[model samples]
Structures are given as structure tokens and as C-alpha cells.
Target: MDITSQKSAEEASGRYCGILAHPTSFPSPYGIGDLGKGAFDFIDFLKKSGQSLWQLLPTGPTGFGNSPYQLFSAFAGQPLLISPDRLRESDLLKKDDFLDIPYFPRDSVDYGAVIKFKTKLLRKAFSNFQKMNNADLCAEYDVFCEKHSFWLEDYTLFMAAKEAHNGIEWLSWEDSLALLSPSGKAAWKAKLASETDYHAFVQFIFYKQWFELKEYANSNGIRIIGDIPIFAALDSADVWACRELFNLDSKGFPVSVAGVPPDYFSTTGQLWGNPLYDWDFHRNDCYSWWISRVRHQLELYDFVRIDHFRGFEAYWSIPFGSTTAENGHWVKGPGKELFLALEKELGRNLPIIAEDLGVITPEVDDLRDSFHFPGMKVLQFAFTDGRDNTLMPHYFKSNCVCYTGTHDNDTTLGWYGGLDTRTQDWVRRYMNTGGSLINWAFIRTALGSVAKYAIIPLQDVLSLGSESRMNTPGTRDGNWVWRYYQKDLSAELASHMKQLTELYGRHPETSVWHEQSGFATLNSRGPQS
Candidate 1:
């Protein structure tokens, strides 16, 4: 697909297949995957596998223990994911500079080492840019910063200030500085002007490299799907810059935080702790902040997957003093009005997928269906309750998107192996196949579903077990660390995926499959309801 050829919501409505793998999972020599060869290679794999979309987690600069959902700036890219190789190609880095870094693990990210080493290298590159400036690059950097200054100015300042303060949270700073008074901000800007400019320089490099990679993917008939977290970190540039948008105290701390109540995933519930949006404040301005956020994301991706989509309908608000998510109340969100504002600003309904997985209410479904955005259905969630579960293939609707597993879940094989015998038996009978080749079986089932888009996590595609899982919810460490080796994207696996996609009529040329072949016929089915 040419970047211009990407289908608008009006252009194509059904049977488009995709894959779920964050760019961080791409194979790379760097401590983590980056916007480099690994990214381009993965795009090639997507094209070869007859896939049209590549869905990724949020690319934001992670905050508070490396969760993408909690980011330093909702608008900025993770600088650590910026490719040093690309920098070298641009003559901003020397080969020897990369060589002296401590050896990094090939299979997982070492966040601490990667952060320290990359920060130092980025500073060096900034210094080099200052010394030997190219007129064209300088012009480009000016244009980039000017174009993004709405958010970039604050983000760059926040990053520079955080570094100056030895990585303390912004709330720990002095009252005037922390609250971002006009004089205080101006004084700080003058004092840290060099560091601020360097941070802006890094962002310019990141965007340039990423846009090139995105161009490569589009030229090869692949659309990039980007993720957007609905909440922002309390210690973020966003909160620091726009305190009125959140439920914060006079001192600029969250009065109430965001989290989910007890659900299938946990007994204590998950205390995300990110500041909740003050929907009334957003409503007063016709959701201008959200409109800008969505517009910015649409600039970077063909499609955006809204994480925790149900939160837009009704969000769980946890008290600021709570240790766990146990004590929280469901608060109304700026539902239809927000989307109306988005549509009015963009002149069309946005292309989005709703992460409507847990504790879904009818209102959530109403909100999703009203906008014609697809809701996700996970196959792993299906087998736990037999074939009749809403997540099962037989229960999927063509407007939905199906996934074998997601970043937060265990790989299919690992999840299956851990199931009790009765549940395993239920799965075997549900698909009418033995558990001998469960991974492929699950893939086949997902592909053959009524869902318009079918996605499989890279771990499930490689049939890897728990250790390869990208994340385990509620855990601080050992998450977002998985990496794939080049060998994992073998010709054999691509061929198999292509065959399954074609067999299920999910190829780009077809819209739906009327013929059911391998999977069992369930209690009632035409198109799943």
C-alpha cells in the first residue's frame, strides 16, 4: 500500500487481517528493537505473510517503571527505541562509540543499562550536531520542533528538568517550578535551554527515522496500527503543562487516580495510578485535548487502537490514598460527545479498535457500535468457559477483531498447557481437534472466525511459551522485555500464516468466508452475534 492508498473507514469495512506485535519485539542488535532494519524487516514479513496491518503497543516515552500506558509525554516517542544504527548512517555517531557499550542480552531488554547508555550516546550525538551542523538538517530540526511545539516544548522541558533533578518525579520539585508558573517556566527555560534544545533534537531524529520506516512499510503494502493509552501519567509533561485537564489537587497531585475494579484478571484489581481525566473539563472545551491527541496519533499511524476503550464509556476512579484498586467507583466518561467532537474536527469518524476485554457493559458496546469501531475478542479468553463464551470464534461478530492472545496474556501454548484437564478437554472438543498442535489450531480457529480482522501475537505465531510473553500485568520488573531472534521469522512460518489467511478468505481480495472447513459447527451460528 502506498501511504496514500491506505483505506479510509469508508473504503473498506471487513475481512482485513493483521498481526499484533509491538516494534519493541522486533529483532535488533540494540538493547531493544528500534526504528531500524528490524522494523523494516518486520514490515517485509507482514507483507509476505499476506497481512495488511501491523498493530503495536504505544510508542510513547514510558514512565513510572517502563509501562507504555504510563508515558512521560503522550505525544513523544520513546527515545530509547530510536535507532543508533540510523544515527550512525546519518554520521551522527561513530562505530567505536557503539562498540564500547556493555554487552547486552540478546533475548530481552535491560532497561537500566539501555537507558543509561543510550542517554549518554544521544547527548554525544547532540554535541556532534552542534559542532558540525548541516544546513538542511538544521532547517529540518527547526521545522520539526516548530510543528510539534504545542506538546514538544513542554515535553522537552520536562525531560531536561527530570534529568537535572536526578529523575525525581515532577511533583517533588519546588512549588513554583512544579506548578509551572510563567516566571518559573521562563527562568527554567533560560537556565536549561541547552538541555531542552538537545531533547528537542533527539525528538527530531526519532520522528525522522520513524517516518522513514513508516514510509517503507506503506510502500510495501502494510499499514501500521498504533496504540494510544487513554490516561496520562501524573508525573508527565501533559499533567505538568495542563493541570486543568485532570482531577488534581492545588499542589498538582492527582486527587483521584485511574484503575479497574476487581475482574477476571485479578482479585485486588489493577491500580494503574495514572491520573484520570476530568471529563467535565474536557467537555467544556469540546474535548479539544482529545481531538489534538487523536489527530497527532492519526499522523503517525493508519489506525489507532484505543487501550481500555470501555473507560471512555465509564471509568473506574480510585481514591488517591488507596494502596490497591479495591476501593473505586465507576464514573461517567465523556462518551458520545467526545467522539462527536473528534468527528467534527477530523471530518470523518476515526479508524479505531476498542480494547473492550474486561467487565464490558452494554453501554460500552453501545459506545463502540455507535462509532462502528471494532472491539477485540481474545481466543485465550474463550476456552476457559467452553465454546459458548463471547470470546470464542463461534460467538464472534464480523465487526469484531480476533486475537489468539495479547501482550498481557501468556502465549497460546503456555496458556493451554496451564489449563486444567477439563478446560483442555473443552478446548479440544470445541475446535474438534486434539491438543497435539494447539498453537496452530488456535491460529486456524482465529483466522476462520467471523471477525473482520484476525491478529496473532508474535509469541503465539512462534509457538513460544510463557518466557517469551511480552508482559505480565501488575508486575513491575521482567515485563516488556521479550525480543525475537531473526530465525523466528522463518519462511516456513510466513508460508503457514499466508496459507491460513488465504484459506479463511481473509486475504486482501476477499471480504468474508462462507465456507467453514476445519473448525466445529457450534450450537448456533450464521454470523456470530
Candidate 2:
């Protein structure tokens, strides 16, 4: 189907609602949320809450700072998220494997502890797999390896190299390994074959478990939205395996890096420090690398949201060692040519959402609108100026996606609490509600918007404070670790969400009384036809 036809299909479905929460934030006893029962249960919660979508952060293995945006491999899954329970069921693990479960904090991920515990368990599982020589499972693993070998082989080898060098970055390794000396490469590959295979086996397990969980979500009317960062990490398998696709020096150092210019959030600007793409090279190959990247991500999600969508039109390039993004300048990107190639290869029915936020220029808007991709709007930004209606619900367009607040922002309750008396009073007047229910006030407005889709952070839905914020941009620590207890997804909360969704036409009017929804008929209030 063409883009117009695909968009019409989405519009015909009417407004849909979603919850923004990463899988790591799911409550679990085993240190972090894994692709296990908790994941399935979360899908069930989304269904109960009248949510049709579940948007999550990237699933890739995080690197140095433990940020998902800066991943080890864009194509590999997070091994730490592999479920031990699932492994045990497959006989790849036994109860004894977890006899010394580490003390992981319940409220937030102690990434250090979780990594140690999960790594030990995963290594043991790999050992058991080899000892048992489980032919059927081994065959499945081999098939998975062969299917993804194009990228998986390089990623596994990269991981093995990282381990061999005591977790040092690739470019900093010895001359032979760093420069890819032919003889040294052969010798090192032979030496690290076992370790590399171990990484490959872990990825096989990740996809196995994730496929199951994603199947469960789809079965229950929940679609997953996955994020894809615009830039590749300088220390990533992508930069290593596809060197020509990035602007890197001969020794693998980035020639220039990625970042955003100074804005309301920062004076020096936010320096992301990831390697910038060599758009000319990508275009020379008809964007094959980008097409493959998007294709791989599409397989993992129902809808793939391209982070920093504006970068396609132009990107901010900072000097390699710049301390801040203030010195960066905008450079023209692949723009229409790249996306046009993607559409030709992947078909125009691509289920994509552009995260068209930040200092958006008319060119960025043109690019996003040209492809019929849904741009995003956050309600929290609406009242920044009392007269700014662009962010207001009443001015929202049907082709967009609306949010009360995103993972980058504080929870609605926390944001309201931070505002001065004047701003707080303005918020109250705008929403036409008292200060007591600010969270729901923002949520209701989002659902009531003309935007075809509305998403609320799990924090806002639960009325959490700043302490539960998932991420705070520009900060290095105390982010992406928030976890919510199962107790927080109460029956009352689900019912309230269902009622609001029904009242605002975000959900099917008749579905409110469906026993599966766990809510009685809300006949008193329903959106007019």
C-alpha cells in the first residue's frame, strides 16, 4: 500500500492510547526486568488500562554510561534482559544457577549489581548448553546465528574483543587488533572463538524470549513501539563493522560528533558525543546501511519511532572533543533521498513515527509531513507561554501523537510542583481544574486532543513525583533506573484510565463494558459521534 492508504488505515482505527515505560522499569525480584512473565503481565496491564500501545526505550545492550541511546550494537538485544526463568524452562539453566541472587535495589536498577548477577547466570547457561549438546535447541541457535550473521557475527566478535581488552574501547586496543592487521585478526578470531560464540548464543536466547513476549503483546491487542537513535555510538559495533558509514578518522576516532545547539534546557547545549553519519557515503550506496538498520528495528517493533527525526534534514556537528554543543553548526543530511530509498525498499506502508521535537525548522516539518509520519507534541510544553496554543490540545492535528510528558521530562505532578505560583495558577486555569489533580488534568487533555494517538508516561498515569522520573537529559547518573512496584497498577487506576479513554474517544465506546476490559459500562459519559 502507499503512504496515503496506510495512513488512512490508521485513521480508520480512530484514536488509540499508549503507555510509555521501558521493560527495565518492570518490577522483578531478579535485579532487572527480563523477557519473562513480568513482561507478559505488563502487556496484560496495558490491555486492562484501555491502552492499545506500549512504547519502550531501545532494547540494545547499553555501554559505558549505561544509556540505551549509546548501545554496544544497534542490532543486538540486551543480554541482561534475558529471562533466567525462560532459560530454566528450556533446561539451559537449573535452580542452582541462581543460588546466590545478588541484592538488587527494588526501587531502581543498580546496573552494576544487575550486570554482575545476570552475566554470571548467562555464562553458566551457555556452559550448560554446551555440556548438554541439546541438538534441537542447538539447531535453533544455529539457525538464528545464520539468519542474523550479517551483523551478529561482527557484534559478537566486537564483544569478545572488548572482553579480551578488559572492557577497553576498540580504538584504544593494541595496534594489530585496533588496526585490523590481517594476520593478527585471524589469530585473535581463533583465540576468541569460544567467547564470541558465547555472545552469539546469548543473542539467540534474547530473540527467542523477546519473540515470545512480543507475540503475547500482539495477541492481546497491544502494539510495541521501539526507539532508534539517529547516531551510532563511537564505541559501537556499527562504527567498527561499517566504518565507511560514519565520519571517523583512520584510527577509528570520530572526525566530528553529534549534538544539539543551546536551547531552553541548556546554555552550552547538549553534547551527545556519538559519531556523526557520513551521509554522502550512505547515499552513494543508496542508503543500504540505513535501510538495513530500519528493517532490523521494524522486525522488533510494530511501530518504530526515529529519534531526532529532524536530523534527516540537517544535523548539528560539533568538533570531536568539544565540551559543549555551542560551537556546533548544522550540516545538511541525506534528507528525502535516504527516506525515499527506504520507502522504495521497505514499501510505503512503513509504520513510522517521527520524534520531531526540539529546535524544529520549517524544513524538518516539511520532511516529516511529506512522509505522513506522526510528529509528537507534549502537553507540559503547552503552558510555557500562556498564549502558545501550538502545544495546546485544541490546536493538535489528527496526524500527530500527543503526550502529557515524555521520558525526558519530569512527571506531570513533579513538573507542576516545580512551577512557581504564577505558572501553577496558569496551569489550573488552562485545564479548568483545581491543583489537586494536575496529573490527570494533563492526561485528560492529551486524550481529548485531535491527535490520533495519546501516550502517557507510566509515572504520570500513576501520579508519581520527580523521584520516579525515568530520565533527566544532560545528567550522567540517576536516570533510566526508575522501577514501579506491581502494587502501583491498581484496579482503581486501570478503571479510571478506561473511563477517561472512553469519555474522550480514545478507546472504543462499547469496549468499556467488555468483561475483558474489567470495567462496567460508562454510559454516563462517552464521546459524541
Q: Which candidate is the best by lDDT?
A: 2
Q: State each model's CA lDDT, in order.
A: 0.84, 0.85
RMSD of 1: 4.6
Q: Tell me the tens digit of each residue's lDDT in model 2 across 1-529.
A: 5433453466565789899999898888887888887788888888887788899999999998888899999899999899888899999889888788878888899998998888988999999989996789889998999999989978988899999889989988887777776677678879899999999999999999999898999888888899999888888888887888899888889988998998756788899999998888888888998888888988888888899999999999999998899999999987888889988988875688999888898999999988889999998888775676588887878988999988889999999999999989989998888878688878888887888899999998887899999888889989889988887887767777777777676764442334454335542222211
Clashes of each: 1, 0
Question: What is the Å distance of residue 380 in model 2 from its true position?
Answer: 1.0
- Structural RMSD, model 2: 3.5
lDDT of 1 by residue, 38-109 (tens): 988898888887888898999989976788888999999999889988899988988888878788888998
lDDT of 2: 0.85
RMSD of each: 4.6, 3.5
Candidate 1 lDDT at 264 equals 65
Q: Report the poorest 10 consecutive residues by lDDT, candidate 1.
A: 520-529
